[model samples]
Target chain A: MPISPPFRMEAMNNQSSEIIYTYAGPRTASDTGPFVKTRLMIREFIDARELIIRLFIRNFSSKYRQSVLGIVWAFIIPIITVGMFMVMGNAGVINVQGLKAPYAVYAIIGTTFFNLFTAGLTACTGSIVQAGSMIVKINFPRIALVFSSSLMGIVDTAVRLILIAAAFIVYRTAPHPVGVLIGFLSLIPLFILTLGLGLFFSLVAAILRDLINIIPFATMGLMLLTPVLYPIDNSSALGVVTQYNPLHYLINFPRDMVLYGSSELTTGYIVSAIISCIVLIAGWQFFYMAQTKIAERV
Target chain B: MADSVITVDGVSKKFSKSVRHMMLYGTLDLTAGSFGIPLARNRLRRGEFWALRDINFEIKRGEAVGLIGANGAGKSTMLKLLNGIYMPDLGKISIRGRIGALIEVGAGFHPMLSGRENIYINGSILGMKTAEITRQLDSIIDFAGIEEFIDSPVRHYSSGMYVRLGFAIIAHCRPEILLIDEVLAVGDARFRRKCLDHLKQLKENGVTFVIVSHNMQTIDGIATKGIFFDHGSLRYCGTPGEAISHYEMKMLGNDAPFPETLIEGSTKPGSLRLVKYFKDYGTHDIRFEDVRITNAQGEPSESFASFDAATLKVTVASPSETKTRMYCSFINEDMTVCMGAYMDISLKTGIQTIKIKFDPIQLTTGRYMVSLRLYDEYLTNPYANGHFGYFSVMKGGCVETPGTNTPYCWRTPEVTIA
Candidate 1:
């Protein structure tokens, strides 16, 4: 009898050939019908949480790994920036007028909050691109990459906030009880806003890599436009600009509640917070719509 | 019952080249006097071209399929679509199970993290739960063969070690559908064999697999079905043998010319001629007729047996005026060089030639290319080189399976005893 050909080997080789031809095709709209199933989001969220923790650890370790001071450097830089702002403001080189709290305390709080917002935003914008190979090779929620990078920034922000509070204690400034409450409460809106903006910008950055260059300039312009250095009241153009700036509410609402014991949220704060929610939803919608194109575009 | 676990229908993916080019133009548009109208016209004229044209396929559960193509044949783009990294621009794809891919091993691994840490991180990326990773962690470590260095930063691991760890984690991920892309080619021989064996085990367990490889031997060895892609389209989709033949045909066109006449020799003998050939050591200035073939028993024969001990003796002539440095190479029928040897012998005038002999050729039964080359003392420059001749080592002794009509056995029937 003729020896039978190696059936298993033949089968394997044939299967591989089929796969080569299988992936070739043009872009068609994906069927989003399956997405209506509620269980998908729950699974995605659980997966995202794991990814977030992993990313947070990686970001933390990688940032500090080769540095001389390691993790201590995280606390040192923020302290220096806060101290520089304090010294400059107190010596009359930088003026802080029309504020209810001491200038150094107010500046520290503003810098801490703003730093968190900008760092999260900037890091999230590059996350998708930096993780380009992963995004393109594996099947996972692309949103995880953006959210995880933002989470890393949040961890840094939390560390800096703790250091600021310790400095306040050392300086003999009596802690306001409301400040603690505001700190926890503010994270909700801040997270919602950052997640939305982060996802949107990450998508944009992946498609148009040059946006990476534009992001820093935009954030700097935004910092100058907001009242991070000086407090804004109703009488000034700066106040009007701050009222319109969504990030201003994220920063000032917590500051006001913490330092000044303001229980009532300002009308501008309420309006901007609503806008922030809308912006976030809109960003998510935009990302959801554009995500299908990301693999091709990137 | 639908055996197809993954179905792709009329899929086409298109990308706009002008859109990518216009990114550069935007900076230029900043300086140009008129940016609006030209940019608008360019955008309008800039249309889309499909990277993947109309294609359709159904992959059954447990099937191991191979994707074969030249560069830019849309093989990678297809893997991306299957992984859900890209939605097809025009087609619909339905997948039934979770996909675990090793498209680029260590794609998401952080260099600063320890190998143990990266396993957790990579496992999560592959959609494995923490509990699952914990349970399989030991297996991953064992498979990777880096237990001693698991805690060291992955940045310190060699590239082979990194790939092993990455692949080990992926293998233990227990994906229902697996997509692999050319990752095996990066590892060494032993590691490659380990991965192939692991993949075979996985296939036996009914896991569906999609693989892309440029190595034809690998495709022949592992794939159950095959697809041939050309210029962003599926040129053929069927059996692996045919696909491999197609690929080989494409490759051979550039290197091997079809013989005009069956007996006609190569026009430029330098490409085909064999000047000097030798194997092993000791014997020198030997002739072809004196070269004896024998079984493991050391009995001399014209045709040697398969999987048996054998020896070959060859003689090299070092003409007085010619350079004495020479190199010999042995190649299989498929034109792959199996092994080689090099030596230099500077001879004075009046010497006719040198005889070289090789004994106990440790080779399996097959046709082989015995080629030779003469070069300078440095061995960098070549003077003359090509295949000297071809020889066959038979599959068995003459007394057994006598006068068999098997396709390859016809040439040696004369040696069989009644």
Candidate 2:
């Protein structure tokens, strides 16, 4: 191995280099600069990758082990949700205009993609609280819990994509091949934004239990405001609300890409992506700072 | 300085008095922290109090330190802080090398998962790599002795099986520093013995340990050093023997040093008490001042080898010339009187001393209590009686007996061919 600095730490063989952890009174900044602290956090997270995978497998298998439906629940919920919206649209209880795709295809795509954000955020938010005893008794990267739960959400969303594919087969509709690829790419920003909010909400929800009960309702409300079930009429009041909602651009960009081959809201999508990145970075820093006391409070 | 593996400076930690306050303050802190405003951590806010206050200690590499304290005396808090679960509100703690804490075994086990799978999860949570766990899988299963049930769901396993599997995984993790809290006696006595033997082997291999236990025997048997915490303060830290004594003294209301006497019950002048002494009842007229047990070499000691000569010395202070019956009995730890002796003794106005010697004290390996009594001329209505002290007989004997080692010989027998 090449020689390195005196302060650098090697995991198992640190005979030559020293690693010291000094915990003192609360301070606004770590003894090391933010840049070094961020590096160390990232390194610690990387070192715990195995634990994250194991946790993910543990939760995934246990969640379905006792149920007869098992993995089918992943697609069942989305299908039932889309079926409800299609029924309402047929009855004219919900009206749509200027939509290129069939109502079934449009509703399926919207519900499944929006479900990614809602389900991912809800799972991530509950991860820390669900592992309360483990957090108090063991010392590991707390972010591993959030990451593993988010992985579960991702895998669950992947399963729902099979449902979306079956919907297109039934409707005899073909999505633009390039737009579909870009649409999958667009889910990255949405995932990042969900993770950022999940990190922040998980931290706060552990301290205030009301947030745990409040998140599902809040996500449902957000879905209505974001036009996930219907097309946005620019003159309607809900359309005005969608204009200010970041999720509006995040969800519509990918759905529009898969449907209409391209989106005219590129500027709004870029701005929302930037906002997602910022939220992720800020949420990560806050989680890192607040994790020290989580064991005690929990 | 580099050899010191763990250093806890003047560290302190605080907790809120109420859950409502905790939620409110947590929300406030998060909100304020987003604005880059730090909380007043050095001082206490409303509904906050220190759990551990300004504690300091250092453990050199390979030193096993035992923490002894009463319930709620901050021993667990100190362990949590050492494990980096909680940050200090004041001062600092610096530690080198990896730490593995056995605060609660099977902490992350999923009920629906099999033991084989939960081992990976639990091991990874303990900072072990997947390859390391795979390498140690068979050994972990063998050590836990649950191979037949390894593939079964953990929820179906008994609590003992669960703990054994958990401990087996952590024991193989090979942490540089191990911190344990009252989890030593996890399963049956046999399993406890196995765990203790494993800990001893680890200590021999230079694994640093910090253990918190209320079982003094466990601490004395394993730890090189002992720390005593009382009411959130470090009362003493020294060799395990001395720290145990200090802790015992404190726990017994600080009335246990040698030569310190306590008088129990009312010693009326002419009451013909027809019953035994309740707890060291004594009349001040004729009393035993000092009592001690000495070894064969005539040096005061509380422990002696079996078949070794021992001495018992008693100092008496009398008001006037009086005659009393001196009675002494050797009682085993189970309160059974193994031997007794009595003699008529004369005492002067001032102080008098008596010495009794036993050649080859025929006691087996165990602790024994000494009871001394001074009865009046009638050999009843005792002037004073006290359970003065205790001593122990260690190894070095031909045979082990319940009460005493009796001198005997065995005849050799010749076997005939069948």
Candidate 3:
């Protein structure tokens, strides 16, 4: 092999003798330097993917073990939330003239995709503090915690999608074939956005635990800000706000991808994709920097 | 065994007591650090203290190094630094190979998960792949002796079962570099023997180890080298025996080489505490005429608990009011005092009784000799001074008692539970 142990190690006299090791202060600036840090972060993620899967299995299995509800909690909560919105819509408290899809199909699809972002972000934000014992004691890439929880989000979102399919069966209608393809594809950018936001917020959550209490409450409000339960059109101020909201494009694109085949690739969709990439980069940077001190902080 | 597996250089790490200030200043440090704007990190900000200071050391393949220190002496911090749990503020540390640290047993075990599941998670956290862990699954269960309860949620497992399972997974990982913090024994005698044997077997297979435990027997047996730290600095490094002696001598503040009769055959390594008896052999330049022991409540007691604070009162008689040094040797019935603490004093011509108090006696439960010895100014001539009669150190009743090693008064502040 061309790679025979590194340069400095070979220069050493022999194995039996004491090999002196050295450490220096604040090492990141010595690098090119952020480039190396980014590369290492990606390398760590790939190298630790097995560990991530292990943690994911541990979390996913333990989450539903022995409880009566079991995996039903994944579907039940979204079912209830969508059920509440449909109840209001049926009572004439809300209007649906601008929408073409059934409220059951529309609401379930929107909430399922949005749940990927909301649940993934919440779990990711809380994962660091939740694994404080391991973070302080074991030496491994801390990103595994975020990755595992985000994977759980994927699993949960998949289960919630089944609820959407079950709704389609109940309604006796089929999803637009092209829409289903794009709808599944849309999950990718949503996950990237969730992971990015999760990495940054998780660090802050480890420090100021008030973020833990604030996240679930905040995500509930964020659902309104996105076009999850409502259709985005040019009418109300809420619609205007939704017009500017990138999540409206991100979440709606996927939901419309499955509910109907004609999910317009708006200029906003391109912007949302760009934003997701930005969040991922920023989150990875912040998480890596904060990691050096997390053992002490947690 | 083929490579230099670990390197640490000029490393220093500081910790802040206040979380709020740490978050604020940490942000400042991170930003200032990224742009090459060196924030004066050397200076301790408010509520910040140096946990590890400009320390440097290294380990080659298959060498076992033991870390010894008083509480808050940064032994655990150094271990954390080596493990990459906490990066040093000043220096860099590079550890090659898959590092498996039993720094705290069950470090990542989810209590809600079953014993079987936790094994996978813990093994993976130690850097094992799923296929590797699966191959070892039966062995892990067999080592832990938890086959029947493998499917039971770990929350339902007894504490002994919990630690056993944790250690079993760690031992099976076969890490090339192992860093263990004070996990000498987790269960009864059978389990203790099993754990020690596993460590011995691992050591024989050419694994490098950095162990931090106050258990001298473990150090004397398993560790080839010992790193003695005091307040975050590398104070002494030598053979395990010499390191223990040096550490003990430093703690007592006197390093008078013991008379040959004292420690000749006393260095036997094992669980058996080799209690030593010193023959009275010095011509009297100064003499210890009387001595007394009292507990913290001022009760004159013959025995003290391991955690009890007590006092030693000594009266010295001398020919002249001359410059002299006084040494008190605190000995346990099982193990000899690794070293004695000697105090410098000017004696009164005839007799002056001095009262010295020990707040929270740092000894495991056993009979002890708070032996008083006197010396000439330069510590040449020595006398028995006086000895506290066979007062027992009763079992310390505290949550800090681990019951296997000298139960903690130090390192207790830094307990990171899994």
Residue B132 alpha-carbon offset, candidate 3, angstroms = 1.7
How should the candidates be ordered by TM-score, best one leading? 2, 3, 1
Q: Estimate how well candidate 2 is docked, as a DockQ score.
A: 0.30
| Cα lDDT of model 1 by residue, A1-298, tens digit | 1111212333433332222112222222231365532343445566578867777777777887768876575677666776776777678875666666666677777777887888888898998889877777776767777778888777777777776687677666754786768655775677678778888888778767888889889987988788777766657787777667878877887877778667354676777677779878777655654565565555
lDDT of 2 by residue, B274-343 (tens): 1234354656567666666777787878767667787777777888988787788777656788667777
Please give the RMSD to the true structure for each candidate, in Å.
10.0, 9.3, 13.3
Model 1, span B1-418: residue lDDT tens: 2567678788776656676653443333322312223322112224545678877887898888899888788888788788777767566787665567889998888888899999998988887778878878888898899999999999999999989999998888766688999999776778888888788778776779899988765676777899988777888788876886666555444344322222324343222233233333323332222222344454544344343444433333443454456666666666677556666656444423333433434343345556666566775655554454445554322322222212222211111101
**Residue-level error in angstroms, candidate 2, position B413:** 32
Tens digits of lDDT, candidate 3, A10-51: 323333323122222123223444477667677778978999
Best candidate, lDDT-wise? 2
Alpha-carbon RMSD, candidate 2: 9.3
**Per-prediction DockQ:** 0.27, 0.30, 0.30
- TM-score of decoy 3: 0.74
lDDT of 3 by residue, B25-74 (tens): 76676556445575665778888988888887778877899999877999
Which residue pairs overlap in candidate 2's backbone? none
Query: A57-158 in candidate 2: lDDT tens per residue?
Result: 988888888889988988777788888888888899888666889888888888888888988899999999999999989988899998888888788888
Q: All candidates' TM-scores?
A: 0.74, 0.78, 0.74
lDDT of each: 0.66, 0.78, 0.74
Off by over 4 Å in 3: A1-35, A90-92, B1-5, B30-37, B250-418
Would candidate 2 be rated incorrect, acceptable, medium or high by CAPRI criteria?
Answer: acceptable
